[model samples]
Target chain A: DARVTQTPRHKVTEMGQEVTMRCQPILGHNTVFWYRQTMMQGLELLAYFRNRAPLDDSGMPKDRFSAEMPDATLATLKIQPSEPRDSAVYFCASGPPADTQYFGPGTRLTVL
Target chain B: EDQVTQSPEALRLQEGESSSLNCSYTVSGLRGLFWYRQDPGKGPEFLFTLYSAGEEKEKERLKATLTKKESFLHITAPKPEDSATYLCAVQANNQGGKLIFGQGTELSVKP
Candidate 1:
């Protein structure tokens, strides 16, 4: 059973701190997506990469948030100078050519 | 702009009860409609994908049906273990594979 994997399931940081979340997509998958989920906004797409290249990041805050897929299996989302409003669960999903996304367990981040 | 809306933000049902969740969507062109189940503190799990009107799919106690304007997830005799947030998303014909998600319906089954 192959599944997307994420590291640091939980993180707590003070305001202005930097937070990084990591994901390892399923082997042989070609598309990766980053999403943020909160009670107020539901699920918001932050970024996505296809074939190891960024296809979209318009939903991300360019001033503080960054998403990168260094290689086919690894993807990362980083937030610098994080604010309290940034508290939420970040999810990473990978998809094959068929486009059905498989999501990881998610990283819960709490910024105080 | 593509948009997806789910009705009854929260629902509660007794064990062995039956109910349906609604998801309405508007897009330039529909590529696919997807259903996902999310547990507390976990990411969404893929459930079903409907590609065209009148398509139906079933898994255990859940069945999903899609129409031109909306989709319905029917739960029959649901158990406590079926409690979770059900999410609906749509992929537009022109948006590549990016998904537009709805607010989701949180279902609670009481024993």
Candidate 2:
């Protein structure tokens, strides 16, 4: 079955470290989305790319978080100087023109 | 501002019981409404997508209906395997396909 795949499903890092999560979207999907899930805020869109070009990153912390689609099949979300409050599950989803997104398993990050 | 809200933050049901979850939204113009099921420690899984008022979709034991201001996910004869967090999200025509998500409704089904 075609599915979005993510790497490093679990991560434990000290505060102020840099964390990088990677996603491989299903082949031929045109849109990729990055989201952060926390109990307080629920699921929040951090950034997204359409056809390998970023469409929005306004929801992300400008100085600390970044998302990029280096190619059609790969997307990445990075956090610099990650903080304890940043500990949450990060999900990557890819969709076709129809707009139905399929999500990856997610990366659970814990910063101490 | 566009927003989505789901009622009854949590619900508990016995196997074979039927119930419905509600999702209300307000947006400039609706593109679509989506339903997803998320298990503990997992990403949300796609369930249904409703495009307009009076639109309905169904899977094996689940039915989803959409209206102008809200949507409903009706579960019939639910099983323990159906226990999960049900999330509702809305895509607005002006928002470039970004899904505005609601705080999910956690459903627990007991055998």
Candidate 3:
């Protein structure tokens, strides 16, 4: 069955280090979304792209976080100078316009 | 700002029992409401989507219905494997497909 895939299912990094998480959306899907889940915040939308172009990143910290879709199948979320507060499970989801999103297994990141 | 709220942060039910989860939302315009089931340490799995009020969808033992301001996911005769956190999200007409999610309701099915 077709599904979204994420690399480095887990990541551990020291504070101030740079962390990058990658996602491969399902084939033929044109929209990708990045989200962060934590015990305190529940789930928060960080950014999303449509047709490899970012539609919104307002929920992300522009000073340290960046999201990009290098190609239709590859979407990436990076954090420079990662902080302990950034520790959370990051999820990637993709879908067609106004359709149900297929989520990846997610990358659990722990920043010390 | 668009907001989604799910009631009963957690729920426990005996096997074969039935219950419903509520998701209340406020948005400028509702494009779609989505239901997802998430297991520990995993991503959210899509369950159903309701586009308008009075719409209903079902699969297996789970059924979802939507109204103008809220949605409900009804579980009937749940199994142990049905234990998971259920999430509700909404796509607003102006959000460009960005979903606003609820805190989720953690359901536990006991035998």
Compare the candidates by DockQ and give the number of the best one. 3
TM-score of 3: 0.98
The whole-model lDDT of each prediction reads: 0.95, 0.95, 0.94
For residues B11-105, what per-residue lDDT tens digits would candidate 1 score against the true structure? 99999999999999998999999999999988899999999999999999999999999999999999999999999999988675999899999
> What DockQ, on C-alphas, does every prediction get?
0.72, 0.77, 0.82
Q: Write the residue-wise lDDT of candidate 3 on A32-52 in tens digits.
A: 999999998998999999999
CAPRI rating of model 3: high
Q: What RMSD value applies to candidate 1? A: 0.9
Please provide TM-scores computed only on chain A for all of the candidate models, following their numbering.
Answer: 0.97, 0.97, 0.98
Give Cα distance to truth, residue A27, candidate 2, Å: 0.4
**lDDT of each residue in B1-111, candidate 3, tens digit only:** 899999999999999999999999999999999999999999999999999999999999999999998999999999999999999999988678888899999999999
Task: Return the TM-score for candidate 1, rounded to 2 decimals.
Answer: 0.98
Candidate 2: where are CA atoms >4 Å away?
Answer: none
TM-score of each: 0.98, 0.98, 0.98
By descending DockQ, how would the candidates be arranged? 3, 2, 1
Give a tens-digit lDDT track for model 2, residues B42-78: 8899999999999999999999999999999999999
